[model samples]
Target: MLNNSTTLVKGIGNEKAKDLEALGIYTVKDLIEYFPFRYEDYRPKEIQELKHEDRATLIGTVQSESTVRFFGKKKSKLSVRILVGNILLTAVFFNQHYLKPKLVVGETVTLTGKWDQHRLTITVSECKFGVLDSQGYDPVYSVGGNITVKGLKKMISSAMEQYGQIITEILPERFLTSYKLIERKLAIYKLHYPKSFEDAKHARRRMVYEEFLLFQLKMQALRKFHRENSGGTAIRIQKDDVELFISNLPFPLTIAQQRVVKEILRDMESPYRMNRLLQGDVGSGKTVVAAICLYAAVTASFQGALMVPTEILAEQHYHSLKGLLEPMNVTVELLTGSIKGKKRKDILARLQSGQVNVLIGTHALIQDEVVFEHLGLVITDEQHRFGVEQRRTLRNKGQNPDVLFMTATPIPRTLAISIFGDMDVSTIDEMPAGRKPIETYWAQHHMLQRVLGFVEKELKKGRQAYVICPLIEESEKLDVQNAIDVHTQLQQFFTTYQVGLMHGRLHPSEKEAVMKQFSANEVQILVSTTVVEVGVNVPNATIMVIYDAERFGLSQLHQLRGRVGRGDAQSYCILLADPKSDVGKERMKIMTETNDGFELSQRDLELRGPGDFFGSKQSGLPQFKVADMIHDFRALEVARNDAVELVTSEYFWTSPEYKSLVMFLEEEGVLAGEKMD
Candidate 1:
């Protein structure tokens, strides 16, 4: 019955059903579950307790008959004087002349509207004949497209009345009792028609927990399924050989890097596949750790593949890894979209014949033509840039190869668990021994001359500087510096130095050439957008200037700041902006105070929320109707723990207690390929 079409409701016709469909409501269950965005409190308030512009409900006796005055065209204003507790107040209504008969002198009336304390006026939005009901809260749904809020409320109420009892519970009785959660049917009722704010809170809590628990259960099942059905061939490499390879490196690994490498190697040696995320700050040597893992796989006569989001990153890794591994008789190959004809054919043939011990490329690595023989290790740099399907495709090329995802964006532990719960996470928290922290400063636009002077000084010392702008071209609505304008100005100002501009609009080859020039020190001052946020490493670049830094999020600013501070020289990141909002100012302040990407990411989550933290498209975070990943983090933790416990126990999906949960997961398509039995 709950799955019946919403047309079964009392007042909904085909057209009205179409309108409801705009809100993603087609079935009776969808209608009932469409929770209100907010609520309006219509409880009667004392006149003395009312503040200026307060939306309040008041009960009073009519002191005078309503007077109707004509306004513009069909518009009319109806005003009446009402007396309550020796105070007289004016209640005005617009185009409600029909209510004049009800507002008779000496009659009691209840009204809800915006109050003007100075004039003691209530601009009535709603009027009733009697005192307010005990249930004073009215749920406000976000409605549109010919469907008024009143109509949506009516349809939802009808759906709830007819099918509320048929709403099945996904959570078992034990969880409800243990967590002190209300019944699903009661929770749904309270969510749509709450008597008080507390009732709404309780109902929202139940829903949030339910959403989080189901999500976590899905994650746990994924993790379990990946582990059990890994089909991984354990690569046996001696610890002594791994130690020898690490010792052979020109630079010693940091303690954090060593620990993470150990974790990766252990997972690789196990029969179960390695599904791990390698999270590190900018220049924290994540690439080195990945290189070491690739070496381990290659030494065991297994091919390794590293996929990055961009061709520049792929090229960067190709050069670095070739330098590191070529001396050890390890063959490395690069495969990207730009590589074509004979060269591309040669690389593909080598990859299939297992001659290419390690292959690095962009999305080209996931193409159908790219095949690997004895492929044992798959590493994706900046993993969030690729979708889940893209990563799966690369992994599918090999039979359950150990997969390592690398990202410079430091996600907070809470978010990492929520988003990457299915994978084991490793963080390289420590920077290299001699690496200097990037000195960040926030300056107003008026101080551009001073910031430029500082950049000139750095350039005079034979260092490169990056000038970042939020926009590629001039935006009329936004008063922010653009890359093209900034580049032209910088070129004119610093005529002696080469100033190159790069943006997303530039062709891939053009962008790569500009990056190469900047990396080779041919370009002294590079004016670019956030295109330089990742993979462009120049040891000589020691200064970064970001115009309109307030336009960027905290994590983004942090990423832009990371463009510099790659070398031993003292690096500086100058943020130029006069932020209007307190949040923008806070973002600048936070950036200047610390260079910890993890700390900045946490603050970014707080300021921008999880949706905008990594961006919704790349975030891999689930969109929950009631549960906020940041605010309800504690509930998520609880849900994850409970999910892990349940999935690992004897009574998992096969048990009668979890029958509803299995059904729900299957319906949600979470168990699409899973063996339920």
Candidate 2:
């Protein structure tokens, strides 16, 4: 029955199914799992109870209605007046002509919005034609495409009624007894149209717990699979060689970097495969740690490859690592999409010949033509930027290579333990010596000229600056400053200095060229978007000015701020925002207070929620419908423990009691290439 098409439901046709498909609701199971993002309380109140700032819902009869346009054809309004008992309440709706027919004179309707007592108007942000009472909380689903909110609700209700009998409970009885989780079907039933807030909360808890459990179980399964596959070429620990490589480096390794290098060495020498995350804040010497790992592997008579997200990052790593490793007689080669003719051919040939001990490149390293002889280790920078499939493909090039994932994006300890539960995490918490923290200041629009002057002063001192805006070009719908407009303004202010523009829309070569100019201190100022948030390192750029700072998340703002202060020169970050706005004020305060990324990440998680904190997908955490790791962190801990035990237990592999879970997990795409049942 769950296999039935949405067309089986009343009022749903081919067009509706196509729309539903856009939302990934292709079957009965999919429809039920597409839970509401929020709820709307439909409790109606009397007109006499309405106040100036009160958000209220009132049931009344329409006494008068008219349409008016203020500016153009697009600027339309539907003026409506209704009588609740003897009190008259007016509602003004802009550009919503569809309400005119439904809201006829003498017809009773339920209108919900903020009341304007001075004008005696209630702006009709939401209104339904028929008068209705509260059925507790009405769920508001995420709907788009050609599907309307009401239409989605009706179809989901129909699907549940028709297929509820076929909705099998996958969680075993032991889980229910141990965890006190609500019944699966009951949770689904009440979650869609909850009887009360209490029931909704319970249902959400059950679902969230289940999602985290499954996610943890999947990770454990991947871990188990990797362990069974046997690590490719384990590189034994070589302390003297690592020390020599560090001593030969241009800069001294910090205590944190030295500690992490030892940790990585331990992982590489282990009999099992190494799945480690090397996390560090900006300029925390993560690259240096990765270099030590590469050097360790190469010295053990094996080849190592490093993959980055962008060509510029690849080039930076290639040059930096080459300067240090080549002195030790280790051959380091760079290969990228931009490399052409004999150069690319030579790099590929060297890799196959096992002559290139260390290879650095972008996604091009995963190409079929790029093969590694005696490939012992694979290292990835900003690993989240590459998808699981891409990483898997790259891993396939070698024989179960020891994998090391490096990221500068800081993850709070709580999230790291739960998200990267299967992998060992090593953090470089200390900055290198002589590295100065970027001095941050919050500024309003009035400070634009002052900030420009500071940029000019920095340029005069022979240092470069980066001005980051949130947009590429002026959007017709948004009011934020775009890079293009900012670039134009900055060019006028810095007449003698070069001001370059770069954004995601720019061509790859153009972006590379602009970055090179900035890195060489040729571009005095580079005006760009958050595309520079990740791995474009220019130590010469010392000043960072962000426009409309309120629009960016705290973590993102921190990343943008990281672009500066890479050099020894005292750098500054000027955030331009409205100082009065709550989000703006709070963000500015937090930024100016500290340079601690983990602390900022915790605050960011608190403010933006875990799903949006690092973004659901990019953080390598699977999407959870109602579960928030920040709010339900304890639940994640409980689920993770239970999942780990269950997945690793021998009983789970052979027992009939777990057959349904095995089948469901496989169907749910959590098996990680391992089949069950």
lDDT of 1 by residue, 7-120 (tens): 898888998999899988889988988999789898888988988999999999999878999978999999999997789989999999999887888888889899999998
> After superposition on all CA atoms, what RMSD does each candidate show versus the true structure?
3.6, 6.4
Which sections of candidate 2 miss by over 4 Å?
1-168, 243-263, 309-312, 326-356, 361-372, 383-397, 411-434, 469-517, 527-531, 548-553, 578-586, 599-623, 669-677
Model 1 residue-pair collision total: 0
Q: Write down the TM-score for model 1.
A: 0.88
Tens digits of per-residue lDDT for model 2, 461-548: 8989889898998899988899999999888888998999999988888989999888887888999999999998898888999999
What residue pairs clash in candidate 2, if any at all?
A: none
Identify the runs in model 1 with alpha carbons over 4 angstroms from their true place.
46-54, 60-129, 247-255, 322-356, 363-371, 386-393, 413-415, 616-621, 669-677
Candidate models: Cα lDDT each: 0.89, 0.84
